[model samples]
Target: MKAKNDAPLRSRQLIGYFVFSILLNGFGNGLTVAMNLGSALWTASAVNLAHALHLTLLTVLLAEGVAVVLFNALVLRRLEWRRIAGNFIFMIPFSFLVSWFAQLIGMTPLVALPLMWRVVLDLFGIVCTGVAVSIYQRLNVMLHPNDDLMQILRFHFLHGNAALAQPLSFVPPITLILICVLATRQAYALNIGTLFSLVAQGAIVGLADRVVFPQLKHRHLVV
Candidate 1:
């Protein structure tokens, strides 16, 4: 009789885990798609300096994403602050190389759009990414290596005060935005779009970490 009761509880736990995992992944996929699309659009639109900046951003983001995946899969295995910082430092050159390539490709400015529209899009993307991270963390699953690093920084350096960490977290994205703004007078038109795209991408990646790749060890246990 005790065994029978335990069986149902185990089944329920399994079902709950699976459901959360699916939700996390689904949200991640959506964010990824949105951010990639936004980046592509910005890259294809910006001219000369603006274009160069866009490409640089893309290259850096891609390098960071790849590095995070590898670090998580191989080196860190579990969250470690030094390992995360090392990963970031290692990827810096890749970011520079990508920027150089963008220059070689000869970037051009994008067609002008309303300033408000740009701002709206950018804000949307940023908000989405933040929300995604929150959701995934709440799921209590493993995070992508890059995110793990960010979380580590937030916890250790900022003493787990999200409010304090939040501003610091925006440093990279904000720097990129500033670069874009300074590169072209017309960049004002793209502020919103750029912000939204980045945030949305973050959110999506967070979701993926939770839902798509949820607690693989637990699943293995069940099997």
Candidate 2:
């Protein structure tokens, strides 16, 4: 069935999932910023670009969301304006939450922490990202626009070739970060976390999809 045509889940239930997902996302973002490194590949690129352009990270994310929506519309030959708009609206709260969490964590203090603790935070961030992404996928309301773009690229553009599509989705984002880093002479955007996310996010998400989503499905708690 077309995603647009699917019936809406109960409002209360869906909202609960949304809240939980956003919290995870916000916390993960906090850890990323606190570690003074990239937590996710696409995020790294977006953050770097935002820095280079002297724009707020939220602004860059919103722009990227719009671009993804446009790209999806072009490829699908149909515009799901509601989904696009929903995702765009979702970004505002997400940005604020991330900012709040980032501030709450106190980046300066986090950076000054011992190296072992920093590694722990990085791992925690990755886990948060993995679980949050998985829950978001199961909720089936609206995707974090770029995620939807990645799906479209994987299924529509790559024709279900996971091998190619998976890596393709990551390469551009990391490459963008690399370019900006070299040009601006700023290495903050690319770090151990970036490499960790590139390698581990897939495994983590895959495990969640295989193990977590199934349990949620069994409980009839998710669509």
lDDT of 1 by residue, 1-223 (tens): 0111122225566557534543433333232223322331222232223354555444545554564455454533455455455455434543343344434322322113354543443344344445445543433334434444455455446544544444444454455555655666544224334444444444444444456535432110100
Give the TM-score of each candidate: 0.40, 0.82
lDDT of 2 by residue, 38-154 (tens): 567777777888888899777876776666677667767787777678677777677677667767886467778898888778778867877787667566566777666555565
Per-model lDDT:
0.41, 0.69
* Alpha-carbon deviation at 72 in model 2, angstroms: 2.7
Error of 1 at 182 (Å): 3.0
Q: Residue 93 of candidate 1: its Cα lDDT? A: 45
Model 2 Cα shift for residue 138 (angstroms): 1.3
User: RMSD in angstroms, all models?
Assistant: 11.1, 3.9
Highest lDDT scorer = 2
Model 2 global lDDT (CA atoms, 0 to 1): 0.69
148: Cα error in model 1, Å: 3.2
